[model samples]
Target: MIEIDTKKLVIGMYVARLDRPWLETSFLFQGFRIENNHQIEQLQTFCKTVKIDEEQSSPLVSFEAFKPSTGRLNGTPPPPTAAPQDQKARFYEDMAQAKSVYDNVSGSLNKVLTEFRLNNYIAIPEVKSCVQSVIGNIMHNPNALVLLSNLRSKHQHSAKHSVNTCIYATLFGRYLAFNPEQLATLSTAALLHDVGEIMLPKTIVDKKPDELSAEEIAQSQLHTQYGADMLRKITELPAEVAEVAHSHHERIDGNGYPRGLKETEITLMAKIIGIINEYERLTNNPNPKLQLSSSDALKAIYALRDSCFDAGLVEGLIKCLGIYPIGSVVLLNNGSTGIVIGMRQDNHLLPTVMIIRDPTGELRHPPKAINLDKFRDKEGKPILLISKVLEVNSVDDDLRDYILAELVTKNKPM
Candidate 1:
């Protein structure tokens, strides 16, 4: 122990307790003048060994008496790595499985609808499993949007609507960053969102996209109520989930059908499905004679973002799908036309595209997927690319064949 110019003394180079407090609680060091009566008594008892002023001593003593417990710190924690390829493969596999389950449920629902059976569709174990699987796929795979874009009309209107709703609902859920559990619930709501349509007339239901009369539209809207009623029959169905399916048709501005709920009254999940449903329907080219490109469909939806769609959700859709989404052909500044392969995370505006043909006025075989990020000129300026929006089938090229070939750019995640 050593005393410095200051009133305090140190027990060791690092560890030091107050001299007075140390005397009362821990008697390890000694030899200091006590100013108070309390200190004098404490210090007297504490002083087993003593040392006065020592010239060679520092203020701190090297008393190695006590040791503190420590924790292990041998290695560092591992960071999460990017797994794009695995994610893409998993997405495809999950989507295929979802399609199978969706088809089965659709078939069963069709039979019920045709027979006019009032039995609860949700009560079926297989139907519930199908809904769960589809929802799970949406929650896990970001790129599953491509697989869910179904336009082919099967015999069952409710089934097709359910699949479409499920896809859009899941996409919207992903856009909102909904957790897996929330996504699954939202997916179930979407898939079964239009089960009530089964009750509608076959003539009105089978009405082509071009020939939808006012009565047909009104009758079609009834599906929302019909679906809700079916869901209500199932005692196990959660009220929140049922609400999503029932209220998906209701609008934010109080202009929607059925109850005509506005704003906060409309459940958030329903609102998401509503926006996505409308967008998908408007954009989908039901007429094989005049099909709209994916880009055109998106643009059409974007045009209605504020008035019809929830502003934030529309923005999220744009962010998720990218500006030039899949299935749209674009003419680059270099005079080459290519179909968009997939969206790039960093640059959503410029997605990875499959260059099918050069400006040489000759069609090329086996289109090549090129990353616009790497297509820069020598001066580091961005090259002229995708100056014009070319609708699918707008050009003379074989759009289907181009879509079938999946040659994506390096480092571009699915």
Candidate 2:
């Protein structure tokens, strides 16, 4: 089977895979021959691409034959509108609020996980409260919560991963303009996406793939079902939340384990969680060699689009988090180095950065915050452009110390 843009799909072609889950729509079979304009129109509305059985297709059309359309697809719910200008003026305040929210959620998660490890029944209300707090912050400003999530500690991988995934899933949902009710469900599902891992032996979860025996690999993959079962036992939670736990590991191409469920079989919320889960693991893998930088993680996910994830959702993630996401360490064209603190809505590539090192390679005692979108040199030329993204620990100086100090300084009362 070969992948083709949905616009290139024609009557008489056999669809082997859709960009979305098969069960979510009305398609009768997992694979079917497109027989009429109605089928093509439906496919176009829901999918950006589909895998076609080359041997089963009629005459193939050139990609250039089609043009991309803008705006949300027909029959799809509209994304949440952008925050009002008055609300956006409180970005700093929102960010500060997000920090407090992050701390509370983190503490609550730690306590909850401790209980789970002891096989104690979880306090569903407490977990729900934390999820609500995260949702509140995300509703105000998702960027702040997302930045905190990206700066997670490696020591608390499992707990932090859960928190980060929750934040990211909420942010992605917001970007898609999901209603408050939808956002809440998505956040709850993400918070417990990895609960099954608590039942697995640490040695197995953390083992290097090369070192793991066949049986160890199988045992490790059981976390999805384990987590789903645990969530189902919580009678108060939505069934969709439990489905997210079960299907977050599933892929668009039917390669994922536990069930190998493909497009349309997986819920949209699960697909969002799956994308973020893979991204978190890629960036925070225990093995240094396996860990990817934020930019690299995005690239890796993009590379897997259509096969491992839906193409449309992957694009949504990239747009939600700018090209150089918050917390990304980058080198500038003028020889300065900095961590991205804010993204310019009008120009994603030009973010607000805190310059930590000067062109002379000297650490600035008071790091300079420059909004690349508005920055210009004495000659009226742009002063700095991001040359490349750097690894989290590439520099000798401690980034967390500088970042925190900068945030505190910026948020200081006049």
Candidate 3:
């Protein structure tokens, strides 16, 4: 048994002992693998030290709590996510392709969202094509599309939310090993999930979710039925799309709106989109100023495991997006600032980062890139550990603009 400070424990460590008796803590098992940050938080809250079984499997990485950081950088580089086992193309190459596909799909989303808002109808052919293209992009290289989704927009809440949710759903679906046909249906459901919100009063729809009154909250919940009803009327779209639209709000423990669905009753796609929808919503909330950082949002959703979502699928989101997901701006333990550009499935803590600023708080003309898992000091210890995640809005306008405009054009990390 290896004893370490509670704060030093990373995700993959196996805990065989605790400073305090196990009975004192809420842990259900005598010994257990720390699977997510919630468990880590619990340990930190209750225990001063823990003994980890090094031999038991888990990712060997640790990240500090989320906080804001200052300073901006000028380097423009493409955001790239960690590719699946059979990576088809390099980061730059796939990034360009992903941009083209994303642009086309976003245009379609904006037009359809506008059309639905005006006339309550959208062309099925146009949306189906978008789904196919998005799925193809994900299959080719998952990095590019995800980076595109991370590019925040301050306008057209409905349109941007749909596209962002779609990107998140496809990424989650790919991780779940869904077939292409399954992806198409899942993507379609995701992209059009909120079309029914147009039926809502402009006053209710326009307000930040937290600002809504009790009556407005109840009225807003009707969008699921409104959306499902709209989708069901479209003969060309699959029945599952409507089902997902309606049931995505349903929780696993049967407390959700529209219809309270238990675990087995909800379709897998609805369940998948349900988790992604909440993550996307929190990440891209009605108020950008109130948007939760990626890791912060993950922690919020992770708290709802089993009761609000499937436990395994919740882990899938962490695996797919990582603790500090791609496009996250973070401060390193060494006092450098960087953006997360990639994630390794095995270890959610250790990700590939593009360094934006040096320790002196000066911008790196061309940002340096390194994989935390591979980069080490002279003693072979990892040199850079993420100290804190910077919120998107917390970044100054120039930094936000730099991320939106410059980050897309650069080809490779290093």
Ordered by lDDT, highest first, the candidates read: 2, 3, 1
Better of 1 and 2 by TM-score: 2
Q: Of the pair 1 and 2, which is ahead by lDDT? A: 2
Regions more than 4 Å wrong, model 3: 1-93, 117-120, 153-156, 377-381, 409-414
Whole-model lDDT, model 1: 0.58
Ten-residue region with minimum lDDT total, candidate 2: 61-70
What's each prediction's TM-score?
0.64, 0.73, 0.73
Question: Which tens-of-lDDT digit does each residue in 290-373 have in candidate 3?
Answer: 778888889989999988999999988887888788777899998999888776566667787778788998878766657788
Better of 1 and 3 by lDDT: 3
- Alpha-carbon RMSD, candidate 1: 20.1
Q: Write the per-residue lDDT of candidate 2 for residues 1-414, one digit (tens) a residue.
A: 567888777786768678888778776445555778989999988899987754334444333333333356767766554343333334456557777888788889888888877766887888998888887666544567777666644444677878988888887886786866787889999998888888899898677666899999899889899998988989999999999999998999999877999999988998999999998888767666667778999999999999999999999999888899877889999899888877744468889787888989888876776778667778877766999999855742366656665554366421
True-vs-predicted CA distance for residue 257, candidate 3, Å: 0.6
Task: Write down the lDDT of every candidate, Cα atoms only.
Answer: 0.58, 0.77, 0.77
